[model samples]
Target: ILSDETDPNRLHDLKDTLDRYQVYDSAQIDELVGLYLSGADRDQLDPILDACVAAYNVGLDEDGQVDFKGKAKAFARTYAFVASILP
Candidate 1:
Protein backbone atom coordinates (compact mmCIF):
# COMPACT_ATOMS: atom_id res chain seq x y z
CA ILE A 1 0.00 0.00 0.00
CA LEU A 2 3.00 2.31 0.48
CA SER A 3 3.61 2.30 -3.27
CA ASP A 4 0.02 3.25 -4.00
CA GLU A 5 -0.02 7.01 -4.58
CA THR A 6 -3.79 7.16 -4.04
CA ASP A 7 -3.73 5.59 -0.56
CA PRO A 8 -1.89 8.05 1.70
CA ASN A 9 -3.53 6.88 4.93
CA ARG A 10 -2.60 3.23 4.42
CA LEU A 11 0.71 3.78 6.12
CA HIS A 12 0.66 3.38 9.91
CA ASP A 13 3.23 4.39 12.52
CA LEU A 14 5.75 1.53 12.82
CA LYS A 15 5.83 2.04 16.60
CA ASP A 16 2.22 0.82 16.93
CA THR A 17 3.04 -2.41 15.11
CA LEU A 18 5.69 -5.02 15.72
CA ASP A 19 9.23 -3.68 16.25
CA ARG A 20 10.92 -6.60 14.53
CA TYR A 21 11.73 -7.33 10.89
CA GLN A 22 10.19 -10.44 9.34
CA VAL A 23 12.10 -12.77 7.07
CA TYR A 24 10.44 -15.02 4.51
CA ASP A 25 11.93 -18.36 3.63
CA SER A 26 12.90 -19.16 0.06
CA ALA A 27 12.29 -22.91 0.29
CA GLN A 28 9.34 -22.76 -2.07
CA ILE A 29 11.34 -21.16 -4.89
CA ASP A 30 14.27 -23.46 -4.27
CA GLU A 31 12.04 -26.54 -4.44
CA LEU A 32 10.43 -25.36 -7.63
CA VAL A 33 13.80 -24.87 -9.32
CA GLY A 34 15.05 -28.26 -8.14
CA LEU A 35 11.89 -30.10 -9.15
CA TYR A 36 11.95 -28.53 -12.59
CA LEU A 37 15.38 -30.01 -13.21
CA SER A 38 14.50 -33.48 -11.85
CA GLY A 39 12.30 -34.52 -14.82
CA ALA A 40 9.01 -34.14 -12.93
CA ASP A 41 5.84 -34.18 -15.05
CA ARG A 42 3.22 -31.43 -15.28
CA ASP A 43 0.60 -33.34 -13.27
CA GLN A 44 3.02 -33.52 -10.37
CA LEU A 45 4.27 -29.94 -10.50
CA ASP A 46 1.07 -28.02 -11.29
CA PRO A 47 -0.22 -28.18 -7.75
CA ILE A 48 3.03 -26.87 -6.35
CA LEU A 49 3.15 -24.07 -8.90
CA ASP A 50 -0.47 -23.18 -8.15
CA ALA A 51 0.31 -22.83 -4.47
CA CYS A 52 3.28 -20.59 -5.24
CA VAL A 53 1.20 -18.39 -7.52
CA ALA A 54 -1.45 -17.97 -4.83
CA ALA A 55 1.02 -17.12 -2.10
CA TYR A 56 3.07 -14.70 -4.23
CA ASN A 57 0.18 -13.27 -6.22
CA VAL A 58 2.26 -13.42 -9.38
CA GLY A 59 2.09 -15.23 -12.71
CA LEU A 60 4.34 -18.20 -13.38
CA ASP A 61 4.98 -20.15 -16.55
CA GLU A 62 4.34 -23.87 -16.43
CA ASP A 63 7.28 -26.06 -17.26
CA GLY A 64 7.32 -27.70 -20.65
CA GLN A 65 7.40 -31.45 -21.23
CA VAL A 66 10.81 -32.96 -20.67
CA ASP A 67 10.47 -35.21 -23.67
CA PHE A 68 10.10 -32.29 -26.07
CA LYS A 69 12.59 -29.61 -27.06
CA GLY A 70 12.80 -26.66 -29.42
CA LYS A 71 16.07 -27.81 -30.91
CA ALA A 72 17.92 -31.11 -31.23
CA LYS A 73 21.60 -31.67 -30.62
CA ALA A 74 23.83 -34.62 -31.31
CA PHE A 75 26.11 -35.79 -28.54
CA ALA A 76 27.83 -38.39 -30.65
CA ARG A 77 30.79 -38.67 -28.30
CA THR A 78 28.88 -40.20 -25.40
CA TYR A 79 25.76 -41.40 -27.17
CA ALA A 80 26.97 -44.94 -27.76
CA PHE A 81 28.35 -45.33 -24.25
CA VAL A 82 25.15 -44.03 -22.57
CA ALA A 83 22.75 -45.85 -24.87
CA SER A 84 24.53 -49.11 -24.29
CA ILE A 85 24.46 -48.71 -20.49
CA LEU A 86 20.68 -48.14 -20.39
CA PRO A 87 18.25 -51.02 -20.74
Candidate 2:
Protein backbone atom coordinates (compact mmCIF):
# COMPACT_ATOMS: atom_id res chain seq x y z
CA ILE A 1 0.00 0.00 0.00
CA LEU A 2 0.97 3.62 -0.45
CA SER A 3 1.37 4.11 3.30
CA ASP A 4 4.30 1.73 3.46
CA GLU A 5 6.13 3.34 0.60
CA THR A 6 8.56 6.18 1.28
CA ASP A 7 8.20 7.83 -2.09
CA PRO A 8 5.18 10.02 -2.75
CA ASN A 9 5.32 9.21 -6.45
CA ARG A 10 4.42 5.63 -5.63
CA LEU A 11 1.10 6.91 -4.30
CA HIS A 12 0.39 8.54 -7.62
CA ASP A 13 1.32 5.31 -9.35
CA LEU A 14 -1.07 3.44 -7.11
CA LYS A 15 -3.81 5.95 -7.91
CA ASP A 16 -3.18 5.26 -11.57
CA THR A 17 -3.39 1.54 -10.99
CA LEU A 18 -6.59 1.92 -9.03
CA ASP A 19 -8.14 3.98 -11.79
CA ARG A 20 -6.93 1.64 -14.51
CA TYR A 21 -8.25 -1.40 -12.67
CA GLN A 22 -11.57 0.24 -11.88
CA VAL A 23 -11.05 -0.66 -8.26
CA TYR A 24 -12.18 2.76 -7.06
CA ASP A 25 -13.99 5.70 -8.52
CA SER A 26 -12.39 9.06 -9.23
CA ALA A 27 -13.66 10.60 -5.99
CA GLN A 28 -12.21 7.76 -3.97
CA ILE A 29 -8.87 8.13 -5.71
CA ASP A 30 -8.89 11.83 -4.91
CA GLU A 31 -9.49 11.08 -1.25
CA LEU A 32 -6.62 8.58 -1.19
CA VAL A 33 -4.26 11.04 -2.77
CA GLY A 34 -5.30 13.70 -0.31
CA LEU A 35 -4.75 11.39 2.62
CA TYR A 36 -1.26 10.48 1.49
CA LEU A 37 -0.34 14.10 0.87
CA SER A 38 -1.82 15.32 4.15
CA GLY A 39 1.22 14.25 6.17
CA ALA A 40 -0.73 11.82 8.29
CA ASP A 41 1.40 9.13 9.83
CA ARG A 42 1.53 5.82 8.04
CA ASP A 43 1.28 4.17 11.42
CA GLN A 44 -2.19 5.64 11.81
CA LEU A 45 -3.39 4.42 8.45
CA ASP A 46 -1.82 0.96 8.59
CA PRO A 47 -4.19 -0.53 11.14
CA ILE A 48 -7.21 0.91 9.38
CA LEU A 49 -6.02 -0.60 6.14
CA ASP A 50 -5.30 -3.88 7.91
CA ALA A 51 -8.75 -3.92 9.42
CA CYS A 52 -10.28 -3.46 6.00
CA VAL A 53 -8.38 -6.48 4.75
CA ALA A 54 -9.35 -8.56 7.74
CA ALA A 55 -13.01 -7.62 7.44
CA TYR A 56 -12.97 -8.58 3.79
CA ASN A 57 -11.15 -11.81 4.57
CA VAL A 58 -13.89 -12.93 6.91
CA GLY A 59 -16.21 -13.29 3.93
CA LEU A 60 -13.79 -15.67 2.26
CA ASP A 61 -13.64 -19.36 3.01
CA GLU A 62 -10.41 -20.89 4.31
CA ASP A 63 -9.43 -22.19 0.91
CA GLY A 64 -9.45 -18.80 -0.74
CA GLN A 65 -7.51 -15.81 0.50
CA VAL A 66 -6.77 -12.71 -1.52
CA ASP A 67 -5.96 -9.21 -0.43
CA PHE A 68 -5.33 -6.85 -3.32
CA LYS A 69 -8.74 -6.14 -4.85
CA GLY A 70 -10.85 -6.57 -1.77
CA LYS A 71 -8.51 -4.59 0.40
CA ALA A 72 -8.38 -1.73 -2.06
CA LYS A 73 -12.14 -1.56 -2.29
CA ALA A 74 -12.52 -1.66 1.46
CA PHE A 75 -9.91 1.00 1.97
CA ALA A 76 -11.56 3.29 -0.50
CA ARG A 77 -15.00 2.84 1.00
CA THR A 78 -13.92 3.14 4.59
CA TYR A 79 -11.17 5.71 4.49
CA ALA A 80 -12.30 7.99 1.73
CA PHE A 81 -14.82 9.83 3.84
CA VAL A 82 -12.33 10.69 6.52
CA ALA A 83 -9.64 11.58 4.05
CA SER A 84 -11.90 13.98 2.27
CA ILE A 85 -12.33 16.08 5.41
CA LEU A 86 -8.73 16.16 6.49
CA PRO A 87 -6.68 19.27 5.99
TM-scores, all candidates, are 0.33, 0.33
Residue 45, candidate 2: alpha-carbon lDDT: 55
Per-residue lDDT tens digits for candidate 1, residues 1-74, read 22234322222222112111111125755776678899878887787767744533332223221111111112
Q: Which parts of model 1 have CA positions greater than 4 angstroms off?
A: 1-25, 56-87
What is candidate 2's TM-score against the reference? 0.33
RMSD of 2: 11.6
Q: Give the TM-score of candidate 1.
A: 0.33
For model 2 the local lDDT of residue 23 reads: 30
Candidate with the greatest lDDT versus the true structure: 2
Off by over 4 Å in 2: 1-33, 62-87
User: How accurate locally is residue 46 in candidate 1, as Cα lDDT from 0 to 100?
Assistant: 83
Model 2: per-residue lDDT, tens digit, 21-66?
4333566446556777897688755655565456447744553344
